[model samples]
Target: MKVAIVGAGLTGSLLACFLARRGLTVTLYERRPDPRVAQVERGRSINLAISERGLNALRKIGLVDEVMADALPMKGRMIHPVTGALDFQAYSASGDRAINSISRGALNNALLTAAVAADGVSVEFEHRLVELDSAVGRMVFATPAGKVSVEADVVLGADGAGSAVREQLLAEGIVAENVDFLDYGYKELSIPAVDGEFALDPGALHIWPRGTSMMIALPNPDKSFTCTLFWPAGSFDALTSASGIEDHFRINYPDLLPLAPNLVDDYLNNPVGVLGTVHTLPWQAHGRTALLGDAAHAIVPFYGQGANCAFEDVVELDRCLDDTGGSWARALPLFEARRRENTEAIAEMALANFVEMRDKVASPVFRLQKQIEHTLERLLPGTYVSRYELVSFSTTPYAEVQHRVHRQHQLLGAAAVAAAGVLFAVTRSRARR
Candidate 1:
């Protein structure tokens, strides 16, 4: 089969590699210049947290070890409060499983290299997809050299949240999409290495949780940390002056102020990126074209599952093809049916985690609850698993994780009520005596 994949990004490049392994002739068309040669645009790059799901996909393609060589494993979240000492919350009950932090650009470049080296795969850079006819599997691209047209047996849209291929599908009225943009925006900043070493502990994902806004720092392979500030969309505009920026950090993120020497410059110059969730009615059209990754469903990054979920989509799609004996007609619908619910569940969880990270992570009650959850997980072993553990450390389907977590919470709530009632009865009996 001849496959054309739009967007040579992380998902698209990785997908190309997967299809190539299946003996399919695949061509990747990317609008942007090759990431291996171009400098990354500032302020927009968010580091990815690669967990089991992402690694599982890479393992299948024999790229897991290569990718993890540059990744740093973060075992837990290090909560930096406004005052007092720092608190740590391990992601897994056993405290051994961790999510790997890897640069988005680096991972993309690695995948692109693999895709290029894979047999039966070719990549065309600077090919901006301008037209796509899913019904006939024909695509037109505007290149710097000139307009180029190609025909393929199958086309996949992994172009990301603002996918041009998806736009063409919308224009043709083949699919419906709904984008729910959060009022918040994020700006990326840097905390360079100090004395040739990391500025903070590289063992955890550092979070500065203010009530309404939050900042998170993930360690990079270069011994630096990529810090992102999530705030109200309009709030970034309020800090225009150097003093204003410094003062805001002093009051909200004091520890970060001294660590980031270029704070003022990064704050003022960096662009604030909008956060949103994209929901598409159907990810496939005419059984000849399909959407995957962020194009199909774009979720916020709070749960750190955006990239992981996209990787899982590639795995599931490959499995569908295996089941259908490489028939696109049977595989496309099966892929969508299998992924839609899981993606929806993760989208909802990611949004809810935003509130938990920015507001609840610093609360005493929230800490106590996490302790209890961890305790239960240890006591019950396989019977009890925290939502964070189920999502990050395991390959459990996202929809099933959501269902299991709900049931566990219900049981815990009932147990608590029963214990409270018994205590009240004992107190009443003592009073009567």
Candidate 2:
């Protein structure tokens, strides 16, 4: 089958490679110029957290090692409180497993190169999807030279949150879209390397969690850090001058002041990106076209699963094709049937994680619960796993993960109460004696 994949970003490029490996002719259409020659847009890259799922997808294409070479391992989160205290939270009970911090641009370029190298894959630059007829698998692209139209056996939209293919389909009444935007937005900042070395611990993801606003920093291959500030939509307006910007950071993120030398410049120059959750029902349309990744369901980045979930989508779609004997008609519906529940589960988890990262991470009760969770994992092994572990370190289906996590939490709560009651009874018996 001839397949057309839109948006040569992370999911699109990776999907191109997967489809090509299945011996299908794949055409990857990208709106932007090829990154190999074009200058990357400034202040746009938010570094990605590649967990087991994402790595497994790259492994299938034999590019895991190539990608990991440029990645830094983040073993845990280093919580930096407003009181200038640092608390380390290990992601796993084992303490050895870690998520890799890789640049978004670097990973996308790697996937694009892999796709272009594949036997049946071709990539077209600067071809924006102006229109798509999902029913007939016909697509029209506006290129530098002129308008170009192509016919495919299948059309896959990996374009991203603001997907033109999806928009066209929605216009044609192929699928319904429901978007829930968060009141908070994010801005990018940088913490360049100091004296040719990382200023903060490179082994951890740094976070400054205030009540309403939070700042997170991830390590880059160049020994620098990419800091993202999640704040209220109109909060940036308050920092009009250098003094105001400095004061804002000093008050909320005081410890990061010395580390972020270009804070003021980055804050002033960078644009604030909006956060939202996109819910589109029946991701596949007309049995010839389907949506994946952010194009289908874009969730907040709090769970660090946006890219990971997209990678999983590619793998799942590939599985669906196998199950249906490579028939687009059967596979598209099966793909949506299998993945919709999982994506929705992750979406809800991602939103909940935003609250955890922003406020609960600083609470002593939350910290104790994490410790308890980790201890349970260590003692019970496979029988008890934390939600983060199930989401990040395992291939458990997202919906099942959520279900298991909820049950585990309830059981643990009951066990804790029973233990407390037993202890109280023993103390009362000793007092009577």
Candidate 3:
């Protein structure tokens, strides 16, 4: 089968490899020039935290080792509060398992290279999808040379949050999409290495959580850190002057100011990227064209599952083809049915995690709750698991993770009530005696 994939990004390129492995002819169309040849666009490349889910997907294609060659494993979150000593919260009870931090650009380049090397796969850089006819399997691209047209048996849209293929589907009335933009925005900054060594602890994902806004830094292979500030949409634009930027950091992130040498320049010059969730009805169209990854459902990055979830989409779609014996008609619908609920569940969880990361991570109550959760996980062993562990360390489906976490919370609440009742009865009986 001849397949055309829009957007030669992480998901699209990875999907090309999977399709090519099945002996299907695949071509990847990318709007942007090759990243291997060009510099990455500024203020947009957020470092990715690849967990078990993403790694499992790569393992399937035998690219896990290559993709993760430079990844740094972060065992826990290091909370940097405004007025006290730092606190570290381990993600797992045993404190051994960790999420790997890797650069988005680096990972994408690796996948693109793999895709190009795969048999029966071709990539066309600088070819933007201008029009797509799902019903007839026709596509037209606007390239530097001129207009280019291609025909395929199937087309898949993995073009990300602002997918042009999705726009064509919407315009042709084949699909409906709704985008929910967060009032908050994010800007990327840097924490260079100090004295040829990592300036901060490289084993943890560092977070400076303020009540309404927060900053997080992840370790890079170059002995530096990539810091992202999540703030109100208006807040980023409010600080126009150098003094204003410095004053804001001094008040909200004093320690960070010293660590980031180019704070003022980064803050003043870097663009603020919007954060949001994209929801679409029926991720596939006529079984000939379908959407995956951010094109199908784009969730915020709070849970660090944006890329991981996209990788999972590719794996699941590939599995659907296996189940259906490589019939696109059977596989596309099945893929959408299998993924919709899980994607929605992850979307909600990611939003809730934003609150936890920015506001609750430093709270005493939240810390106590985490400690209790870890204790229960240890005591119950297989019977209990924290939500973080389930999401980051296991291959459990997102919907199942949500269900299990809810049930666990209910059981814990009931046990607390029973313990209180027993204490009350003992006190009353002793007083009467």
Indicate whether candidate 1 or candidate 2 has the larger lDDT: 1
In TM-score terms, candidate 3 sits at: 0.99
Candidate 2 lDDT, tens digit per residue, 188-261? 99999999999999999998889898999999988999999999889888889999999888888898899888
Against the true structure, candidate 3 has what lDDT?
0.93
Can you tell me which runs of candidate 3 are displaced by over 4 Å?
Answer: none
User: Between which residue pairs do clashes occur in model 1?
Assistant: none
Model 3 over residues 207-247: C-alpha lDDT tens digits? 99998999999999999999999999988888899999999
Kindly report which residue stretches of model 1 are placed more than 4 angstroms away from their true locations once superposed.
none
Which structure among the candidates has the greatest TM-score?
3
Task: List where candidate 2 sits over 4 angstroms from the true fold.
Answer: none
RMSD of each: 1.1, 1.2, 0.8
| Steric clash pairs (candidate 3) | none
Query: Can you give the TM-score per candidate against the true fold?
Result: 0.98, 0.98, 0.99
Model 2, residue pairs in steric clash: none
Best by lDDT: 1
For candidate 1, give the lDDT.
0.94
lDDT scores of the candidates, listed in order: 0.94, 0.92, 0.93
lDDT of 2 at 183: 95
